[model samples]
Target chain A: MLFRIIKRTDLTGTQAVMFRTAAVFLALLTSSVFIIILGNNPFEVYASMLEGSFGSVYGIKETIIKTIPLVITSLGIAVAFKMKFWNIGAEGQIFMGAFAASYFALNHADIPRPALLVIMAAAGFLVGGLWALIPAIFKAQFGTNETLFTLMMNYIALKWVTYLQYGPWKDPGANGFPKIANFHDNAILPKVFGVHIGWIIAIVLIVIMYVFIHHTKRGFEISVIGESENTARYAGMNVKKIIITSILISGGICGLTGMIQASAVNNTLAVEVTGGVGYMAIITTWLAQLSAPVILLVSFLFAVLVQGGAYIQTAFQIPQSVASIIQGMILFFVLGSEFFIQYKLILNKSILKKEAKGGI
Target chain B: MDFALLFAYAVHAGTPLLFATLGEMVTEKSGNLNLGVEGMMLMGAVMGFQVGIATSNPLLAVVGAAAAGALGGLIFAFLTVTLRANQVVSGLALTIFGTGFAGFFGQKLTGKIVPGPITTFFGEAKVPLLSDIPFVGKILFAQNLFVYFGYVAAIALGVYLFHTRKGLNLRAVGENPAAADASGINISLYKYTHILLGGALCGLGGAYLSLVYVPTWKENITAGRGWIAVALVIFTTWSPYRAIIGSYLFGCLDIIGFRIQDLKIKVSPYIIDMLPYIVTIVVLVFISMRKSKENAPPKGLGNPYFREDR
Candidate 1:
């Protein structure tokens, strides 16, 4: 049968939500094929995944820890993406931020606890913002392709951290093992009820970002620039300044994630500080459609997938990559479902009749 | 350090990159910025290695790799071309999927060796007269069949992209799809064909790594070479011929750290590892500063086209 695709201009909110939900269901159903191939029952494997992620208090805590970075970094990415700036260097920014925070933590352990924590946060924010600023300046001044430029920066940042881990920052007490020294008590972030203060910080930022993006004048300028740089300029916006400012905020927030992860989770900075969270945040940020509230929901769901994926690796003797495979499938199905939301396919009756008559 | 051997090894190391850059260049020339080269290469590497082990045939392995890569390309094309999804996000999703797919299957193949016959089949053979030349001969003429194919592919792609009528039509589509559509060019056909062709070449590049470079299966065997290839496409300004130089230069950068260590130079290996990425950023800045129109990306690049929207 012949088919024609037509754009749908009248999609309702409920319909869009239904499409996404169906896409997610389809992703799980398809990934079950792989689970079956691995000689496991699909339902049991999926049940194990759910049990693993939310089954126990520890499992729940680990999921939240993963969610913390995902949420913070996604929020940061949303800012630059709102201006169509494609800042793909969150990985690099996170590393630089962790490095900067670690430097002060290691050298000045004598500072008071609250004061040291504040300084580390400031250091991460500044260093991460500056690391991102290099590309922003090049982009504004020369119109360089930010996508590839930011990507290159990720490696550079990674190598820098690697250098520090094996060279200067190598703990002298570890008997030649290449690892950074653990943070002093003053350098660590205190826990709230059960988790690190990062969760509290995450919620606060969500509120601030919601207000900044939808209610503020600068945020309105950002949307205008995203729509069309020419239109923003016509409306007397300083386009270059806005781009630089938004990226600084974006990169700074990512840097804060690095500091939190290092001080709270790892208790020491290393090359694995970001652990692919930087790249994954891009996905969550996009899936969230650049909305603060939606980012929280999406990141939480993604964390469940990650935590469950990790759990299945041991429980079922399955490889850790099954989780990655499932995540990829979900992304693909969700991405494809967007097309259905925006357009509809119709059967072409005339073409079908012609084909039935065997006419060329 | 032996300079001659370094150059030879640089050319050997660069062969896979040349293939990937050429593939991505073709895809981008059709106005689709697929950022899934790393994932596609991994898929090719794993599939090629598996087929090589199964059939003990080098040719079949390569074909398998290319087919696997094309499958990856097909997924990307369906999303970005037919579904009109955001190109950047869709490409990232493809990369994630490809990485997982390769990792899952490749886990069993770890430490397995390629069959003896396939290894011998890919072994180096020197060109008689060409191998006799002092510096250039050793670097270019004396290499395995896979490396030789890289040279041919580079020249062939250059001719196809710049000199052929079909190539011109493809470029027109990338530069201005609405105009190309108005002129009766099949924009979707050109995009799908080029994108698939691009994916196949990327697969070959991945196969080169597993079947030729290392001759074994390893998770993430591409080791960000796919990403380096993506950067090289921009570094070479979408020209296949320039890709040869860019790939080898990066290849030299890749091995220079090892060469330095052999010479007892005190430089940190990590610092040396950072050179290629740093150079790409610097070169990108310089290229953008020049503001050369010819060096810019396609006008319609990264935007989904709908004849009705126009």
Candidate 2:
């Protein structure tokens, strides 16, 4: 072999940052080749993306609105991932949460706005948390594969939502088109400043999550469990309880995101309500390494990509799938970069000896 | 419903899944839990569809799809095997990438005239004497070449995994990479080879969808079959023969939905669509509940190997 990889003891903070930046730069550079193949300038494409997401006040608002769900979902996902629980069912949780909120809104249309919002929030959070807990409980009790379990739940939830839109919950006034009924005025989250209150909630949650993960004993226990179950057990940590609670929090938060998104953004439950954010949040949380502030920033960037990707669809005739491709590349490069951070490539032993002997 | 007809329909619907599940089974046997089969299959679907349309050759399309899927596997290998990234995350990234790649190309290919020759090529091939046999003939012999390919692949894999020396080594690698390494097996070599081969199979599965199953280019044409294949691997308890059975069963469940809808049943189509997923969860729960040691997953699964640490 020309080169051998040697595992490093650790990477410094600055070195880690450099590796991430390099990965991002390389991912963009690689994606540029695809742009050129399509007869487009990568720089122009990127500039338009930036402009589309941040150019006008409307663009900014849309970006912020997009960021709200992403930040909340990713932050919620971060909780489960912190314990290495692998809760990939955030999509389902979000849907269930939205469904619960919608159910509340539909039946309680006559209720006061403020009270209805509270009930919807509670309903959404509880439903989402319960949905998430199913997999967590199974994993805790039976040691079942949660990743597959959670993933299966997502399709089930999606199908359930689709059924609702087409069947019992279909809006009677949509003239036979399969559309879920719009939420009552009381169900909608009121806008604060410009965007809905989801942004404020997300910000507050971020701070709470940061404090919970870093400064709390429970967070410390989660880190230990993530490192090793045996070690956590030896330390007298109730690993099962922690795992269940963490996933509940993760799922619950994702569900709350659904409620906010449904009430504030879409104003109706649809099969596409989650908009792939659940899957996107999985990557974002992983990319952020479960850091709350980093998650917020990463999600913001993701929002820009999504908003801008849609923008470029009409502005430049580029398919929105281009954004997915770019996002995948970024994630791939970043994932690959972790290898470089943990292990450095070096010349193979024979080559190293030969080079050293030949050197003056 | 005619039992034999439903069985035949199940076989036809199950071919793609059988390929994917077998592919994933092989990959998992190398201790790498790849969850990107969906993406790889989609990539294969688009590429094979394009090639089939261009050349009008089913054989060429299968080859093309396999190659496309292998390309996906190659990326996954570099990330998980060489770079030692998280297998799950890398697999997810591969799916996202593959899906995007397929969708982009698929969008361009749609509404364009390339003359689909593979459609004619995939016409049913009823074995002359075999077709005359009883119900078994209709259920097994009367099918497209792809269906036979799936059967042969499954049986071949079953034999290979249980009967061959190399197969034993591959299993050993998955079960205990460190032990395999100590016993002079090149763990990385087996991991990469099997992962890539598995990827190719997944790609073929995807190709089967575009070139054989649906016979058209459309966005997300594979639907959730890739994920279903992943679940089927578990349902089969990692056995190729079991995978064949599990795939057909799931396939029947899927087709039954449409069959019921055609019969004017009052059931919502979406509810019927949920059967496979719900069944998967139920199977997963049951399998775990059994807690049988022999049915357990590979011990070294999902963990990166660091030789120096050991």
Best by lDDT: 1
Clashing residue pairs found in predicted model 2: none
lDDT of 1 by residue, A1-360 (tens): 388888898999899999999999999999999999888998998899999889999999999999999999999999999999989999999999999999889999999999999999999999999888899999999888888889899999999999999987899999999999999999999999898999999999999999999999999999999999999999999999999998999999999999999999999999888989999999999999999999999999999999999999989988888888899999999999988998899899888888889964
* Model 1 agreement with the true structure over B1-310: per-residue lDDT tens digits: 6788889999999999999999999999999999999989999999999999999999999999999999999999998998888888888888888899898889889999999888998898898999999989999888999998998999999999899999999999998999999899999999999999999999999999999899888888999998899889887888898899999988888878767878788999889988888877877888789977787778787888987787
Q: What does DockQ give for each predicted structure?
A: 0.76, 0.74
Inter-residue clash pairs, candidate 1: none
Off by over 4 Å in 2: A349-351, A354-360, B112-117, B261-266
Give the C-alpha miss distance for residue A271 in model 1, angstroms.
1.2
Q: Residue A147 CA error for candidate 2 (Å)?
A: 1.1
lDDT of 2 by residue, A1-360 (tens): 788778787779998999999999999999888788778999999999999999999999999999999999998898888888888899999999999999988888899999999999999998999999999999999989898899989998999999999999999999999998888888899999989999999999999999998999998988899889999999888899998888878899999988998999999899878998888888888888899999999999889988998898889898877887897898899999998888888878898788889994
Worst 10 residues of 1 chain A by lDDT: A1-10
